[model samples]
Target chain A: MSGADTVVWMVQNAGSEAGSREVRVCGPALGPDLRLARLDEERLGPYSPGIYAEALSALIAGERGEERERRTIVLLPHTYQVAEFAPLLAVQLGAAYIPSICGAGREAEGGGLRFRRAILQAKLQAEVRPRARTVVATLQSGAFGSDEPPASPTRVVDVCLPADMERSHERQILGREAAGAGGVDLAGAERIVTAGRGVGGADQVSVAADLASALGAELGASRPVVDNGWLPREHQVGSSGHTVAPSLYVALGVSGSIQHLMGMSGSRVIVAINKDPEAPIFSVAHYGIVGDLHEVAPALTRLLNERAARRRS
Target chain B: MLPRRQTGEWGLRIGVCIKQVPDTDAHPRIADSGRHVDDRDVNWVISSCDLCALEEALLLIEAAEQAGGGRPELVAFSLGPARVEEALRKALALGADRAVHLLDDGFQGGDALADGRALAAALRREECDLVIAGAQSDDLGQAATPAVLAQVLGRPYAWLVMAVDLEREHRSVRVLRELEAGMNEVLRLELPAVLAVQAGINKPRFASLRGTLQARRKPLERMDSSSLGLDPESVGKAGAGIETTAIRLPPTGGGGLLIDNASPEAAAAELIAHLEREALL
Candidate 1:
């Protein structure tokens, strides 16, 4: 295809405005002539991968076009959901499903397109080529700049959840619970300050918390912090925890384990503060400070507070 | 097919799908071909999240036993080369009653979908009450296998499952799925459902010496492509829907600028100035 033959953006209401924004940010990269397929969360109710797959299959099959040599791009919101849906969608549309895509662009050498994603736990980035006619991918949060140009007026198609979907009774939504006090909504936060094991005692976590408060950032934790009971499960960020793509991610005393990096590598700007100079977090950090987080965190908070005072004056 | 309730000696027959993956902490060396990483020198272990899934199954078995119901039979399943038997054995050692190893030369390089199809085929033979797998494998990290297997097997599925509660009396399971921003959705799935469990849902127990000895003697069945009656065209490289064109290291980020100052206060101020210059503060 010369350009993208057709782009289908699967927009899911993630119960947050930022979720919608993240979906829209991929529009520019998808090129014009975008078709917005809004997956109404209210209608779909809770997520069941099987039901969603059937619905998506029906939607794609309903499209009237030549079966072969058609290029389609499907954009998904959450990576976890993407994992659940991509394979089924790819099978339905005869596409290649790529996960954790950070960038996509027309191939300079080849006539088709290419995608860029991190592999080896974010230690390496791979440029991928989809041999299939259709390509399905989930863009990492914060991968694309949010400065999207006014999109071309496009039709939003509402995918109705099939009546038979409820008849199965195989999948049910019991209820939802709050993540708890230490639970930080890292995905929605523009700024995040994360603490790791190197932060020492649980009491020292307050120092990082103070810095986060000064910067108007959410407080996040590596696996060890949560494992050690210094923070709640929801505060944890890594393969096991929430994947956050904030504007600014400040790592305090974190050694930047590969699993932790996998969750936060999409941040626009990363700042690392660690006593050890060889910490891997510095590799991806825009700025680094080699100092004890106990002292550095408090000092940074103080300076930020002073800046705020200066602004007030 | 509607899942039938259990009314026999066992409370629930649970199948846990696990994988042997290169340790995530190991230094990854891109192969000479650059299409994939060289695993020859890397030590392989059970994918981290898979351990959590195994632990979850073990916990469920314990819960069933405590509820006055007979102990549940937990089966660990894996598909890979001969080396993968090690991982299945580890699962057995960790408390699985039995294991099914799907091994064949043709099984190599099967993408997530192909692997799922093969696994689903194997699972049909086991006829378990519930199937659990890691949210995603550490190697591909696509997190698609269990969901695809559920679809192929015609079963309901949930992903990123944080907690699973079995209501044996109701012939159903209630699972808490972790979503974005610390939000969790509680799902009640009928029996015979598949769940891709998240890591840290439970702390995986190390195998006791006694458990390890028992695992060696436990039944570990081996099946291949022919035993499952799978089509040759639908597995391995031929079955892979996505073809990897190239693999190369990502370009390094901006040179990490270390802020040097005489005092902590000075360092903090310098960092703020840098953030200001970058319009980040």
Candidate 2:
């Protein structure tokens, strides 16, 4: 493992009242090394990419001379906001920027630190090494669960933003709104069967839907299936749609984009059926069948129905 | 007839960056060096998301014209080897007023930062009122160049944009940005900002025969490193911040069982027995 001698956690709080609560909550887990930065809505308004890039660039640059030579790795959660401004921050600091990173290790050749990132819509993986001393990377959510707090408390320093730091005059935040009306709530589902683009046309979606019905599973749809109008927007399962972690997840004809996999990879048991053996979905599946869904799905549905009939008699 | 907009003054100019990528349908074979995908004999096309960005630019210009605003000029920009001109010509056929190509041997093998620097230099020369591009490329899928370009150009940037509405005076634009789990945030950016459009924003229109014919006469300009006043060392492989040590297939899951295809009945029977043994059926 690549170990860091020093670690710093920057916490963002809106108002003075909530500021104390954050310190109380984050102090224990993050230990003594917590830096609080105030971004009250009254002063900065809703989250602005301009303010974030400026604030973070300053904080990261403020490291002492002795600490700077060891190399700095700035890790951000791969959320929508971080995805927007992290690259800009990297440019401002002249550091390497690698987004959607899933893993890290030391390379065998030079023993240099390397990061793993998904490419080609998660169909392939690339091991990237930073050419610069400072690196900025966004870790894909769920890729790394919460870590245990440190045994020893470290030094802490608070970094404040300039009182006259410019606001985002070029961009203004209007408001946030839900993408669609409350669609099918799949959060509580025990089992889910998600149909993907390889499921073919709207008429062919029944192959997966029937299997879902026979297995007593909720019907889910990948982004492309929903985008093609084969399924409604509510049934969509992905980062931009719904994040579900059911007990069982059976992906039918799904190629498994990164966003889609992030949402459902936490399921207890995963089964993938697709004609393409190289499909990324198989990488995460507990059981996989390489075959046409049209043939495999109907056969499974028939077997389930026969078993149900026998149980009833 | 569409209201004509002059090139130099009193008209808004929107620059769209387009990238040609290997078709997603083609399986990428790792090259011998193991640093990147093998580009030989691969079919290339304009990335789907970038096509949406171009379509959005054309729509905004048309809307401005219909609202009695000045006819907006749409200029398409692309940076790549000689084959990139094909993508630029296609952009012209799709309704762009002009096209600019940033081509040079020095620009090859660049990371996002290097590529963005070269693009920002060319865009500065054009004095574009606005810039737009796809949120991510279909090949590398890095999704960083646009943001880097925006930072280098010192402009406000918005990613995963779903909707765009320009103000009547053409001073600012209102856009909706896509967030996780079907959430959206509405934002307004002043003119001269950059936007990274997401897929599914709008359906791109196909080129008409007349449009294709007229595109042949459209002026296509080529630019090199010296012309853009950029140091060659700071704009390509020499300036890259990250190095790809290797590209390989992802490791499979924890000893996952792989069942080969057989007769549908036989496969289904095997699956049922396995599920039953695990008490999952």
Candidate 3:
């Protein structure tokens, strides 16, 4: 592998928190494996599509001089795939893409073909692999997994970007913007306590909070909770909210929907607490408790606190 | 409509992502293997809300062109398989100057995240000032793309964009943001960013008599994953990391609770007892 003449590492950098200043051109390898400096080094992010993109740009170019020069970074995108749109899009932009058919069956993991609907409703599953210099990877949602993402110390480079105001999309932005809002950003939390409809209602969310506080974790809610206006939209998890990859995610009273699960399935250790025995959340949960959350949440909180106290003593 | 009145002589290249969804009302037909959806049986329509986003792109191009400015090329990108050509052509016919296709053998299976990755990757080769796409896909309603694509493009972006007004030379944008609680937030975003427009933000127009005719002449581009620099692992099931293992649709909530009532007092007591028995009290 040392025969690698030129080695380049591309990192996704973004806005103020990471501060945009550098430029990474695609070239070679990513050097050494990343060794995280701080266990608390988390990549908490926003959910708004606009903000997410704005922030991501900053992230990719935010690093220092050498880091930016030697890195070939690309931003992680969040968009939908239309069955027929991908091929046509590939040609229009003069870019190549691999498409895939899903929602039908599981991947055999080692195969290249499947025999499903023959044709015309009988479709085969496929993927789009790009054949260009820059690779746009639709990374699997849960690929990042639960962990404190490692951060490497790097040099910062500043580049003056010119104005690109040729479009009619002129909209003056105000308020906090999508970059600096603070709420339940469980996608990057080291530890998270998330509530679902099983939590009963907004009132019971506080109990999840109590548990979160005991664990020094963030509080997150599923879409239902947000829809009812019990929790802020920022706190909603799943496909709509931040796609988190927390180290430890404790699900309280939430019956995991595919959407909700898609967002948090990346968590390292998932402990699901739901009263429903048949709830889908159990399929991927590392640990599960089938009991009323009202009883379980408080009890679990009390137990964790006492354990921490005993350890301190 | 008047590009000359706005930013004189400079132009903007715009991209619109359109999806062809089976009519929302289409029912599922299960075969021996699995459920099959006959898109033909269902009316094929432009993503309901994406029309607004596309119209916005069209207006911007017209405005920029009128300004005697840079060349504004509106390219429509369709992501599905060959079948998506219909939607792609529709976008072109509607007003897009050209079109591109990003479908391939392996792109057929996966979830929203996978789709987003592929689209963003395809966009990397092209240089455009603005990438305008709908807020979400109708079937999955996984409003994840615009943001995720922005992330992939490594550009600043915004979503629920109610309105976008660009001011050239100053490099500023005036935007109306739709808040979750039915409130609207206004913002000014710098250029070279992504924005997911809210549905109904603009009045989407039908193809005009002349415009529809001109669309057929618009050039359409087509490509596959083998052309883009992706992981080469067929993006569909072969490359997928997660396996469904098993999937079961949820059962419809069986009718609900039944309460018996005779006398008013008796009825009240019956409900109370039922609540206690259900541990709902």
Candidate 4:
């Protein structure tokens, strides 16, 4: 609850009746008192940043006016859709915009709220303090642990956009398409060996592949490897790719981005090999060897093969 | 939307906002203040995603030229101290027709909101038909400036743009945006729009010898806060909505067992033995 008196929930484009019922069922986790509102797409049309920002800004402004003395914190789940429009909403409301925050607490000195966010590609953590009266924060995926909430009754409310609100003519959605074919399935793999940017280049990807073959593990790749065309899109493992909870996961030269960690942090046992001691991948690895993958990978491969040969003999 | 600025022959004018950040590969030390990275010995480079944004603008202009739409001009914009001029010069070498450096002490120590406001003022002066920027900065990764700039300028905006198709008429553009879970949404926006490009859209090209030499002679304009009619209170730390109080190394995960640095064979044997003990081999 973060010490909020009330929590208002909005389900983008959800129908009024169905939206209310759904909120009652799942909205208790927010707080004991709830206010549900819907930005019905049926009335507003397809997703547009301009329209969505306008509507959301108007709603939050109205709420702020009602809760003028108290601190107003607008919380949202960080997602692709929210990433596109939340900044604009914050600008319209003259609020601070903090994206991908992992934790929060009140400062002991001034009693001001502070946010924790990953910076420098998750290599460092930054403590952010908002200087504005209102704040719009987007929570990073899987950051805060879940807790049970007390049961509470929900009261639905209607938010009125300005009477002159008009559909934006600036943009129109054409359609959607799949980003890749479903050729690789990393979710069900018992063991995964992921190659990251430190693999050097496309020609060097064979080093990780050989290790994977020795371990009888599926070959996976961090976003950079796939982005650089070193691997196919289907092999990508991250928030935008496959989320895997494998028995064993080996990360080779992977400087773990937060999104990459979110996807594979559930592995039962994780091992990382990289040249940099400060790499973020080491933070999540159960066993880490800070050494050159070029030397370590081939040595492990040779030893594994020799053990296999002895077993056969 | 602002009226299109008049040009001699080419009507399409595209502006790119490039940011010069500390190289991600560099091991930056925290300053004594604990507020930001100590950049005294840092290697600075144009952020990777910003370079891709510049490449996308260059590609758009080239495509327009090939279609007989006349030669469209590309302008690059950036805000920072004098070192940022180097980044703008690099942009010129890569094919930007002109460069604007918002150089002023008043613009220092600002967060995304204040910086966006200052940039919007500078951009309004240019009245470009289209504005482009990287979706996020490599150092901060805030990913807020472009959207705030668009909102301040009252232009339609898109984030994480993967592909851009300019209409021959120069009135609108179709863009493909990357979404979560392997989904892509296609959108069409009228002219006078802002786009925050994602990386991996294109491989940015290097500057040729001829281009680098020519860049030295190209016009690079510097604009101070007063030149852009910006108030000191509205452009810097005074106007920032948020401040970074501290930056520290991230905490490590549980079960952290760091293998001792040794010969490759020795390390490999130890790792294998651990796997065998865990019955994971």
Candidate 5:
């Protein structure tokens, strides 16, 4: 039952509001005995992987001072950056890097630290142990409830971007536009209604959209829907797309490929509508309707809209 | 900004790292060893995202050619068993000028870091101005290789790039990166940098029959671990810092109650009632 004496939370403001949520979610993983330290991203400078890695290497090296038996856990907020940064930092600090981690706790038996991560595309969860003295990992969105106790009071370390650290002026910031030509923001949506290939055709997407409008939910879709150009890339939900943990997720005609499951598996309540009773989406759905989405979606929308109109009158 | 030299014979020497993966649509069977899947019978294809990287590389070369600039050489690279040659050949068929195969039995079962070290070594051997690779592999689903390779080569890198524009005269490239919540960050990078490409960047082109024939004559260089001068102790399973103890299917979802009403209205009514009963509405 070895325990870490200090845990460092690395938060990057990659031009998103999820930065603070990342800290709140990862805070509960640390044991009561562990001390907390934070590495805050102070600016939105052009990110050069080499410079970032060098700065982090220096930071970790400075922390590895006289304590021979000390163990440090570094937590990253986003999956993409974690995938990009964790391994490099791990090699630099002689630590073990794990990705898509969902939970962490003290091992029940050995008291050694154990982390849980999904493998095989969220189809399986594995308990991982670090073979090195330092453990570096990234937490999946929606893994931990955000309502947990506030993080411990800790020292905040700001990583100042060196002006000359841009690696021989090889990288520069050009410009950015909101994702999706339609500018859909799925992550912030409380409820999402997603369409899949089973929605039949591009014209049939309106059925799903109508339901979303009636329910006051954001419109999302599976990869095929986006690939087929029925929806923009930003509306896509899957491993390759955006990961969302909305309060309610209503999947229409979705067959639930493992890729799509990886994105919305964290939804608090899942309702699936599909004609195929054998669709994999039913496996995770709390409530399922085995009917054609074209028919069921319109009926559901009308029923809800009628109720709303009646209540207003 | 570095002063641009006169356009030479090659505008940009782009290197793309690719992988051959079992078709995701195939049902994966756990092998007898349980540590990995039995892929002997599965149909192999270029991992989906890698195709996007290839497409992006080809597009850059095409744009350079259309501008009447120097010709760009697109080289595809891969590290895996001999079966990976099929993927490299496909990249050549899709208009890559050449391919490099990092093949060695000793390289099997290596983790991302070990593989990245070997790849970085291979990339060092080529005179490339830009390196592009898929954000992650479909099988392992770990988006670590390109970034780690960038670290090993001491080059700047960006991942999940949605769009790219090259400024040949300025010796820099601009890219749009996808972030969370429908936002993007645009970055400009100097030449000789790496980019981990995401899908949906472009529609990948299929190989024409003539291109398929031409690919046979294209250069396909094969190199082994020893050829790359990698230390034997620093590669393969022994050098992998992480190990998978087991692989198993995820726990099944709690039994889902299905409402199979014959009529659409009935089904909608049942769904609303269920949501209300569960206090989910």
Candidate 6:
């Protein structure tokens, strides 16, 4: 637990405007926390730790009064320390964890949540009662809260290091720039015209072309298209590919593998056409056509062309 | 030249790509013919092991902020339906300040490969330094998203990342990757690399009431593929280049072997009899 006593987790902000400075932190104190009576405390650091302190000061002052009491706070110094610190972190949070349940079952389910599925699935049909205060949440990519508990941002405290930063490997984020101009962002697309194995090959993609052109939609390809080199790397879809949440997603000649299904299952409307009625793709599809794509494509294309032509006329 | 802090500290920006999956065990509903999972009733969760990726990113950001004050503001993102906003908020509860949701009906139909292309585009738009994800989703056994995303994005990436660290001022990162043979390969990538995370890689945090309430206030940005200008034919099952002939849960077989053992000598005779019965001898 990050120093329960307010004085233990103190460190200096070497990178701040104040060249040489020290700040005391007891735990991760947020603006919403309510341990101390006032925001301005004298012992936090030399000159209130600058902008870091100022921003925090304003944040905490907003919360008039609330209970900010935490049983414990697990302070992990860096990313590499999480694995080493998790067991103890769980302990500190008092998480009632059940392990053997899923560990043995996941292997059997082809690596999915085997144990949790049975337990939660059975109960989910019924109302899931809110359990305990201890919530096992996966923190996002960034965000280290304040140093103190909820008491004082300006309070200074000393700390004893648990384990020094002994990362076997060093890591950092340099900069992130887009590869280039966008063509088709399937994940965010409102409507997607997707082709599958049924499309046959590069020669058969014309069907998708027609449908996409008809709808004025972005074209997408399933995994097989990329593997066959019929579609570019950017067009593949599935759990292992781009997870799109579009409005009208049309599936042509695609069999629904669970892996592939997971990617597009979030769409609002799923329209699928395949000769095989039993193809898994139809299960999730809002509209399923048990027909040959070869015939369907030309018919649909002609109809769409007629509609467009009539609009021009 | 390496982008460095004048004071010898490294700054970091990290992004966590999360997927919301149905609680498969929930068996919410059966498809019309009764084989596959029904989309309407699938109870979803933030997904397994992906949280570990989020943990890894948050910690990296925290450390960077703490060490040199060059911190990463957390951005949690997901591509799914309108309902997935709840799942995205779950990430925010952990510490992310903002979320991006690609919640459009157009993305609903494609296969996995098509899905990867779309996600890569969203990430490209964000322009984040690092994109971390669970090595493989618990629902789907196909551990193919990361590699495909990396391929599409044209960025160097490592899968099954066991350990990740930004050391000695964050110029580059030293990564411990688990290769197929259970061997560990440690390499330093310059920066802005994708890391498909392993379970043992990090300990995820629990949401405090404060964080949970804060998530309600965080902003979630929703965008569509149309705005991104993607070709509609390239999404959903229609976008899949491959076709599925059929999907069905196979029949289970139960075979029990019987051993005839009366006594040691008698047992030998029984074994012979049993083997003779089964034609195993």
Against the native complex, each candidate's DockQ, computed on alpha carbons, is: 0.49, 0.71, 0.08, 0.70, 0.43, 0.02
User: For residues A1-313, could you state the per-residue lDDT of candidate 6 as single tens digits?
Assistant: 2223221122232223110111112223311221321212232222111222222223232221232443212122211222222222232233221111111111233222111211121112111111222212112111122332333344432221223222222232232323213576777777788899889889989889787877677788876676567777467676445668787777889876544665687676677777765565766675556667777666666665665798799
Q: Would you list the clashing residue pairs of candidate 2?
A: none
Estimate, for each residue in A1-313, the C-alpha lDDT of model 4 and write its tens digit: 3335534453333532311232243344333445555566765567787887788778778776888775556655666777788899889888888888877666565456788899988978999999987788776766655333323445555545667898777888989997778766688899999999999999999999999999999999998899899998788888667878898999999999887987888798999999999998898898999999999999999999999889999
In candidate 2 chain B, what residue range of length 10 has the lowest lDDT sum?
B1-10
Candidate 3 residues lying further than 4 Å off, grouped into runs, are: A1-173, A176-313, B1-8, B35-40, B65-71, B238-249, B254-281
* Residue range with the least summed lDDT across 10 consecutive positions in model 6 chain A: A97-106
Question: How would you encode candidate 5's per-residue C-alpha lDDT over B126-145 as one tens digit per residue?
Answer: 75789999987777766788
Candidate 1, residue B34: how far the Cα is off, in Å: 1.0
Proportion of true inter-chain contacts also present in candidate 3: 0.10
Give candidate 4 misplaced runs (Cα > 4 Å). Answer: A1-45, A146-163, A306-313, B1-10, B276-281
Of the pair 3 and 6, which is ahead by DockQ?
3
Using TM-score as the measure, name the better of candidate 3 and candidate 4: 4
How do all the candidates rank in terms of DockQ, highest first? 2, 4, 1, 5, 3, 6
Give the better candidate number (3 or 6) by lDDT.
3
Local error of candidate 3 at A113, Å? 24
Indicate the docking level reached by candidate 5. Answer: acceptable
Model 2 chain A lowest lDDT segment of ten? A22-31
The candidate that achieves the highest lDDT relative to the unseen native structure:
4
**Which candidate leads the pack in DockQ?**
2
List interface RMSDs for the candidates, in order.
3.7, 1.5, 13.2, 1.7, 3.5, 21.8
Residues A76-195, candidate 3, lDDT per residue (tens digit)? 212232211222222222222322222111135532212111111111122222233222222223323223343342433232221441223333335633421465456567888888
DockQ, candidate 2, comes to 0.71
Please say which candidate is ahead in DockQ: 4 or 5: 4
Query: For every candidate, how close is chain A to the native chain A in TM-score?
Result: 0.71, 0.82, 0.50, 0.81, 0.74, 0.48
DockQ of 1: 0.49
- Candidate 4: lDDT of B140? 85
